[model samples]
Target: MGDSHTSHTGVRFELLGPLRALRDGVEIPLGPPKQRAVLAVLLLQEGRPMSYDGLVEAVWGGSPPVHVRNLVQKYVSGLRRALGDGPLLEWTGSGYRLSGAAVDDLRERRQLVDAALAARDAGELRRAAELVARAEELWRGEFAEGLAAPCLAAERLRWSEKRLSVLEARLAGQIEAGRPFESVHELVRLAAAHPLRERPVELLMLALCRAGRGTEALLAYEELRRRLAEALGTDPGPALRSLHARILRQDPALLAEPVPVG
Candidate 1:
């Protein structure tokens, strides 16, 4: 959790989708929701010690039970019993610390993304795309999903945005690598799914223009413009505006061979 260990064996903690713990590839049954919530908070901290008050604030938000500390201790104890009291989780004087032996899905996903970027920088386009695909596969669902605790829900949103960024990067890479037409269909779905995310729409417009469908590209911009006005009471930002302007001018630059993005 703190740093990359050479061995990704041992215990694995999955916080990307659901709160799950696996030892040697076998799922370990973590206790009830509260106990799993405690583990979720610890897992998010990534080896940093979480104090009692911090755990309560995260798990219970503004309305913790009367004997919250005792309940916390009880949950921790239950977790220990369920996990066989291994040194993976420990009390570090003031608070609980999860050891680095646990291979977290979040950390693994970041590593994959970094590798993908490295592959792109080296011009190994196929390898880079494969790495990105692998990274995308790591997410089974939302972060710490199906957990109702306030803290877990917050993490779910944070990771959701990050995953979207990863997907956007993949689309951008393919689009800039002279595969604009191929990118159009995927970008259409992505833009629709996240209507306010202008980046996907930007890519969609570029792809449309590259495919010699200038009119359709212009219509795409209009649709986004209207959607923004209808939803947020705002117009597209300068980036989208400038792209729209270029498409209107039938910018020759749009016809130029695409450059691969790093």
Candidate 2:
């Protein structure tokens, strides 16, 4: 592993959106989509060497053009020129590896999320919320947007799910800290965006109820129930239903601080 300052001086790869490279705070132009895809594979693998065959499969899936190895070499050479001096892209046996410390936005976001969870577990609610919000800010949009490579699908999905999980965890923490009103607008937008996801709707309902808008909370539940039934021929889950019942009975427990969702 390289020193933190050395890593900071090297090339930093961004794959959270379109593939981009930056060194000393200036953007480095990665050639075309295919070239970017190749770099993306290597970066996603960290410093692990990817064999020639593996690179081909990742870049082109099942059908690769003739003389694909030469084409891949071309891309690698282009990347080397674009990367300049700091980090080294080295050929290992029949494979290639990107060496030197590189910062990945996705990895950084995950680290922030992990830190937020640790803080929350340690009863540092305010610090946890701030960290999770910072993590959420790292996403510009979908991961590898405009890159149509099959090799990136799994990682993209994993990052997307983790982002949502972090967002929900943040909301839950806010609600538990008697800050439900603070997350109302965000919870509403999230519920509207993902009508079928019960968790956001549940959070929205809880937030509304906590804010003394119990009627609106019931309305949100009704809308979610109708949407779920119409779209998936199913009703809201038991937890939500029980919550609805609690709200209807004006359970004083609703006003009490609740446990954070894991």
Best by TM-score: 2
Clashes of 1: 0
**Which residue pairs in candidate 1 have backbone atoms (N, alpha carbon, C) closer than 3 angstroms, thus clashing?**
none
Candidate 2's C-alpha runs over 4 A off are 1-9
> What does candidate 2's lDDT look like per residue over 22-98, in tens digits?
76566789888888888888887778899988988887889998888889989999989888887779998968998
26: Cα error in model 1, Å = 1.8
Candidate 1, run of 10 with poorest lDDT: 1-10
TM-score (all chains, Cα) for each model: 0.90, 0.92
Backbone clash count for every predicted candidate, in the order shown:
0, 0
Encode model 1's per-residue lDDT on 1-262: one tens digit a residue.
3223222445667776787777766678988888899888887786789888888999999899999989988988888787774536788889888765454676778898999999888877678777888888877777887787888888778878888888888877776667788888998999999988788888888888888888998898999999999999999999789889988998798678454342
lDDT of 1 at 116: 90
Q: Candidate 1: where are CA atoms >4 Å away?
A: 1-9, 85-87, 257-262
TM-score of 2: 0.92
Q: Provide the RMSD of all predictions against the true structure, rounded to 1 decimal.
A: 3.2, 2.8
